[model samples]
Target: MTKLTLSLAIGDYDRARPLIDGRVQVDGVDLVPSVLSPEETFFRAFRHAEFDICELSFSSYTVKTSRDDCPYIAIPAYPSRAFRHTSLYVRKDRIKRPEDLKGKRIGLPEYQLTANVWGRAILADFGVMPSDVTWVRGGLEQPGRPEKIALNLPPEIKIEQAPADKSISQLLSEGDIDGILTPRMPSCNLTDPNVGWLFEDPTAAATEYYKRTGIFPIMHVVGVRKSLADAHPWLPGALFKGFQQAKALALDLLADTSATKVTLPFVEEQLVRAKELMGDDYWSYGIEPARPTLDAFLKHHHAQGLSSRLMAPEELFHPATHEAFSV
Candidate 1:
């Protein structure tokens, strides 16, 4: 039988490294993997449908899915998951809490980014509606970055692009913006005295958030081009099984502390703490396991005027990945 040759673009994560390096392979498929940054991968994928399979921004995926125009169909293999408390940076003297963000100018790379959506959702929990703040959109490292997908936001939400010559990080450091909500830490935060975190203790805040919400937010999902999935109905299940095998291998390596797989100190202790807080399969993938987090994100995605309507967790993935067959 001839194998299907497909291009796969995803981040260079340890969990995905096995798939990238050929230790884990999708059944009857020849995967040509590209290890790219999320920004570049998402940009090329959304704008041009450049890859056969790729990691998609959860928020943008939902936006397109709700419109019924997405070119790719996703499986429930989440490649990126994060807590958003650490994603917000604010002016130390001007803003002290989430409530201080009201009526302020907050900078972001894009309004539809999954991280920013979660960041805004965190603020909403403090009674800060999307309409209460002016969002300044610009690139994080360079100027004039635009949203990968066109958004038709509601009139109540306000967003303006930063000057063509300035990045959001530059705007934040100069006090032109009161805060920045981004997936990446702005470089100026290390050098600028004015920049600091809104959550003084992000670890504690994130822990408390997990304890309260039971949500370890998902950022990215694995997508297969719709045309390809339709042609090869078995492909989505093969991809899901491949990703699960890769993730299990990575976790096994992480738990083996004989030489410390990661360079960080106290890796064992950190792993212990994570398991204690989030259970053994903390970074679980699949629709039902991640329903609450997905539902919460979909609610915020609609409420913040990104998605045209609210979507269910199952709607984000292909039907083949909804469940697995058992012996």
Candidate 2:
């Protein structure tokens, strides 16, 4: 009956809840779940080690800021029924093709974000060089904040301060920005009546690239401090079971219209988005990063110079747990 603290990002809780809700059992251990957003939860976890487990992005995992001793647990990849592809949105009347983006100013919420990273990679695939366009960095608070710059951006790219009063969407609507790189969600509709989608499937090219190069980018992952894992060896197993249970519950709910209707609005929206981006076959099972997937991610991480050395997927994750839950 050992109590294990499990932290999940707020944005991802809907999918993770069932695992820690006590329905899933692992070696007779029970998992207790707590949820928070990535920044708030991880920042606190790093300071106090308050939670035994947490969910984090692959980029965040590679960052120098993260604790070195944390061990990642691979979660099953559930086809994001609500997943949407990121798109390069431009003022419809202004730019009609990908080539038209040359010399155009593009607005980004932050450079360090996965959307930006993948967006840049996608642009490269389309024959756009880093120097061919102007990049604008947004969401700054004071005169200088190092977090303001996304990361590892080349010198040719210029960083402009976004307005303090308006949201990026608002700015795009005002025609202050020629284009933006964002997910294909309704909320990111560029606010401009003139704004239209330039690239329909930004990740498609990347996905193909990954399949070809065996270098897929990792988005989000569940992490546990190595100290906590050592203190409680059974904890990792318990968590894996909990996640399996959650995935089962999610699948069951998705199959039931009555249950789906009662779920959170965001969950419903995600389902729609996933279908649009990944198509109908996406929801057959959860999406878990397997060995090949992790290997692909590691290769890309190294190529991007995001990590100093390539950390083997086995080193970053719990070996036994991953094998037991191989998806």
Candidate 3:
């Protein structure tokens, strides 16, 4: 088999380190992975088709898939997954509860971001529909943030652009926006006492959410260029196996408490608790195992008008990556 060398833009996650470092191989493919932040990777990948493979936003991918003009075909390898309970930032005075966000001016980096999709889904569970809040879109810490892909939001969902001179951080601090649904805190949040997270203890909220709905929000998935996948059909499955193996290696390293692989204390305790709540494959990569989460995301994606049509879990990835044959 001739090995194809391709550029892959991905995050510098511990689970994906093995693949980038050459410790793991993707069948016959030779990967040249450039680890980058989600913002840069997803933006370039969608905007310019910059890399052959990269981590793409699930919401954006669903949106592209619906249009049937997607340049990339997704794989089952989800490199990033979080509960998203900590994603919201609200003024302590105006927004005390989730329902209080109704009719408020809510700011976000982008409406179609994976984190925003999950955040809206959770908020809707509390009876706050996407149309309920007036959406203010802009950068979180800086200026000139735009949606990764085009969106045709429904008539009821009202969205406005933030002034080019200001960012969401400034908007929140000045009380121009009542709250923000974002993946991270505003820039002034650390220095200013006026801005704070909507959920004080997001971990507790995430745990309770998991307990209630059994949903672990997925953020990003591996995407391969559709043309490349079409030319080399084996590539998708190979990529899946490589990522799966890389994650397996990381998990094994996590269990090795002898040297304390990470700087964080209570590694063993947190691992035990996480496993108890989400099971061993909490950071899972597959169709069947993640069916519920995928289905939930697709439902919210369509309900929120991120997708023109309701996409299925199976439609997100290449058909070959769905199942494997074992000896």
Q: Which candidate tops TM-score?
A: 1
lDDT order of candidates, best first? 1, 3, 2
Model 1: per-residue Cα lDDT over 153-234, one tens digit each: 9999999999999999999898899999999999989989889889999999999999999999999999999999999999
Regions more than 4 Å wrong, model 3: none
User: Which of the two candidates, 1 or 3, achieves a greater lDDT against the reference?
Assistant: 1
Best by lDDT: 1
Model 3 scores what on Cα lDDT?
Answer: 0.90
List clashing residue pairs in candidate 1. none
- For all predicted structures, in order, the TM-scores are 0.98, 0.69, 0.98
lDDT of 3 at 297: 94
The global Cα lDDT (0 to 1) of model 2 is 0.55
What is the Å distance of residue 24 in model 3 from its true position? 0.4
Q: In model 1, what lDDT does residue 314 have?
A: 80
Clashes of each: 0, 16, 0
Clashes of 1: 0
| Residue 201 Cα positional deviation in candidate 3, in Å, after optimal superposition | 1.6
Off by over 4 Å in 1: none
Q: What TM-score does candidate 2 reach? A: 0.69
Which is better, 1 or 2, measured by lDDT?
A: 1
The model with the greater TM-score, 2 or 3, is 3
Give the per-residue Cα lDDT of candidate 2 at 299. Answer: 56
* Per-candidate local distance difference test: 0.94, 0.55, 0.90
Candidate 2 lDDT, tens digit per residue, 1-327? 644434443234545655545454545444455656655554555445565566655555554332353344433342122111345777777887767778888876655554455556656666775567776655422222234213554456666767666555655667777777754332436244686667556456445554564434445566666666677776666665666566667656775655554546666676676566545544332334355555655555555445557777666656546556435
